[model samples]
Every structure is written in C-alpha cells, then in structure tokens.
Target: MSSDRTASHLARNLAALRHARTLTQQELARAAAVPRSTIANLESGEGNPSLAVLVKVAGALSVPIDELLAAPRALVRHWPADAIAPRHKGRGVQVRDLVPEPVPDEMMELMDFEPGAVMGGTPHLPGTREFFTCLDGRVILMVAGDRYELAPGEVLAFPGNLPHSYQNADALQRARGVSVVVLAKAGV
Candidate 1:
C-alpha cells in the first residue's frame, strides 16, 4: 500500500484503540514516552512517525505493528448462545460468560438466581468497578453493609473491591441480571 494509505490506517486504528481503552492522548503519550503532540499528529494522520515512535506506541497499546497498518475491518462480532457453557456456582445459581473471549481489564457475566438463591461476589483489584443490571424479576444486592433492591431494568454500580452479594427477592420466581466489571489498568 502507499504511504498515505498506511498513514490513514494507522491514524484510524490508533484513535480507535485509544478510545476503546478510554485513554486520553496525553495518557497514551505518557505511556508510550512520546510527546502528546506526537500522538495527536499521528491520530490526525498528519505525522510521518519514525519506526522507533511506532514501536513505542505499539508497545504501549499492547498491539502488534501490523495491526496499526492493516486496513480497518468490521467491528461487529456474534457469539451464539450454545457456544458458551454456563457455570453452576451453587445449587440454585448459574453464571454464563457474556464475553467468551478474554478481554483485558474487563469481564461480563449473565447471572441467573433461582428462588431464594444467593451468590457472593469476589473482590477485584483496587479501583475496579462493577455494574449490575437486573434484566428480569427482582434481585437484592448487599454491598458494604447496604442493601439495594433492584427490579427489572434497574442498575447498581459499586466498587468491585467491596464485599458484595446478590440474592433472588422472590421465593417462586427466578431472577436474571448482568454484571460488568471493569478492572484498573496495571501500574495505573
């Protein structure tokens, strides 16, 4: 491909990757040990960066150099239900992986709580956050000595490092919820 094409790809990929990680240009520059203007210029497709700069940026993003130069591809991905196996946490609790593939610093799970079922949440690293949303029925969430009752479509956000647990509020109905945990970046 031509240099302009390669630069365009790099600009798009770099911006997308940075946004996906929720990093500012200044933050990425600090991580890559480059000037913030360098990142800004690169993302704008106005910089013809040196090989050393590219290598540093790639290393900071934890991606290969080829990815920065490759043509953009569709981001949509489909995961069939049967493709993922559910984990039985206990007699009445089931947890299914929402994201089958490993994602850095993030995890998502679909949880089902049978009548009167309870499941304790595992604490994560400091600065991690957990978001739980009730999709069906009702769920009782206990965190840090506080109790929250969540109905369908209700959401609760809390520190992932806190002691927390979930329980089905109904005695004869099953409760379903989705939990998304975002972990802190290492060394940050």
Candidate 2:
C-alpha cells in the first residue's frame, strides 16, 4: 500500500479508539504525552503517528498496539515489525519508515511528515546528511537562520548537524512529505 493509504488507515484507527472512550483531545494528549493538536490531526485524518505514539495511545486506551494499528491488507515487505509501525526520533512530529525495517546497515529509512508538523527542536544527529521532498503540499523548512519554502516536486538537501524544523504552509490539508537520511560512509 502507498504511504498515504497507510497513514490514513492509522489515523482512522487512532480516531475511532480515541473517541470511543469519551476521551478529549487534551485528555488523550496527556495520557499519550502528545500534543492536543496532534490528537486532533490524527482523528481528522491529517496526521500519522510513530510507533512510540501508537504504543502510548494503545496503553492509554487499554488495548494492544496491533489492535489499533494493524493493516488488514498491508503486509510487511520484510520482518513483521515493519508492518507494525514506523519509529520516529524527535517530538511534535509524526515519523515512520516508508520501507521495511532492519534497513540495510548501509542505508537508513525515511521519516514521514504531516501538515503543520515540526520535528522536536533539538540538534540534529551527526554522521548523516538529510534531504526532503514534498509529496502533496508545500513545506516550510527552517534551519540555522535560513528558511526555504518547498513546493511539490522540489527537493532540499543539507547536512544533518544543524538545528532544523518544518511547517506545512497550508492552512488546510495534509502536507505530506518524506525525510531521507543517508548515513555518511564510516570513517569518512
């Protein structure tokens, strides 16, 4: 299945489970340790959650992670874990692998982004270079006092050591995109 479909499916599952229990966005946010807007976005089908999020939400709702994140028609391309949920680094942003896990040691996986999302404000990790491309909408990228607004089909590449963040320029709709981290060759 496509990333969009998978994201939509996960969002739906989260919404259903979150609402069925009479939990407000704020309540769920507290229980899950996510932002209230994140919950709103998930329920509205405009956000995707990382594996950590899936786990926290499941724990708060008192259910198994599989119950809220299983994809009926989507099977893992490799290990079963790949089909479970993608893990993320950073906060206030949803991220998951776009490909199967145990990504060849030579390569890394993609981090998915949603509308109005920003990766946690932290220093980027070393030993890698990162790139991004907008899949469906515009994205505003800011780093080291520089800012760039990228439209669909545009791509940006940069060293991953600078502090960085992103935002969806759209006032509405999901600003879908992917972050590619190509790890530097060892002993470079």
Candidate 3:
C-alpha cells in the first residue's frame, strides 16, 4: 500500500482498537506516551506519525505493528485477477493478495515461482503464524532454521514471526502456492 493509504488505515485501526479497549484519546495518549492531540490527529488521519509514535501505540495496544498498520479490508469483497496488483514481482517470482483488504486476524496471498526462485528473509510480528499450501509443482517453506518440503496439495503451518522463506524445490520447473498469514490477537 502507498504511504498515504497506510496512514489512513492506521488511523482507522487505531481509533477502532482504542475504542474496543475502552480507552479514551487521552488514555491512549498517556499509555502510548504521546500527546493527546497526537492521538486525536492520528484518529483523524491527518498526519504522518513517526515510527516511534507508531511503535509506542502498537505496544500500548498489545498488537503487532503489522496488524495495527495493515490496510483494513471489508468483511466481504472480491477482486478479479487482472484488477489485483502483485504484492511482489521479480525474476521468476510473483505474489498477489488473494483478498482485497488486509484482515486484522489474517491475510492470504497467492504465489508463483519458477525453478530457483527464492523469496526470503521476511518475518511478521512476533506470535504470528502462517500456513502454506502448495497447489502445483513443488516448493520448500522454511521457517526459522528448518526447511519443510511440500508437494502439490501439501500444507505446512509454522510461526511466521521468525525469519521465513519460500522457494521452488525443483531447479527446472515451476511452483505455485497459497499462503495464509494468521495474525495473533487477544483471547484467540
């Protein structure tokens, strides 16, 4: 998402989460160690909060930064393949969100990989988890320091907060998969 869009999402999520927790603007400001006006402005989606402010807010809310910042999606929506943009595109690798909006609890993406394609070193907020299901060819889903091999129709789930990677297992073919990222939430 563009920075403007992200800030808008942050504004919406911040207000919703704070209200859900029964926190007033002043209360959240105190908890986040920011000015009440800062909270107010953020809720209004009128300013670009610094990274420190964002971290403080996320910490005070007990949510991972990603969940707090992710663009909110409607509960029900649809996106045609051509209308959807790839989250990442590079030599031998492509990824697209399966849904229109990023959900607070989870998000899913579709990935395509050519032999030798590798997407690596990405990690979500602590306590997050991911499920990867191979839909075609073969792939390897690596979490932390372990590698899990997957064939078509195989599914693997693991902690996503740790460093993780995905790659085509075969050096001469292609692979495809769907990844479901589950964001940790309170009481879940």
Residue 89's lDDT in candidate 3 = 58
Tell me the TM-score of model 2: 0.48
Model 1 misplaced stretches (Cα beyond 4 Å):
20-22, 46-65, 99-105, 185-188
Clashing pairs in 3: none
lDDT of 2 by residue, 1-188 (tens): 78677767777777776666667789889877888887787777677678887788777777788766557554324557546576665443556666543332223344445555666434455766778877777888887779999988888887777778777777665676777766654555
Which 10-residue window of candidate 2 scores lowest in summed lDDT?
100-109
lDDT of 3 by residue, 1-188 (tens): 78888879988999888887788999889878999999998888887888898899988887888877887765345667789888665568899888665444677889999898998836777788889999999998788789899999999988888888888999999899998988875544
Ranked candidates, highest lDDT first: 1, 3, 2
Query: What would the per-residue lDDT of candidate 1 be over residues 136-164, giving only the tens digit for each residue?
Result: 99999999989999999999999999999
Lowest summed lDDT over 10 consecutive residues: which window, candidate 3? 72-81
What's the lDDT for all of these models? 0.92, 0.69, 0.84
The most accurate candidate by TM-score is 1
Q: Model 3 clash tally?
A: 0
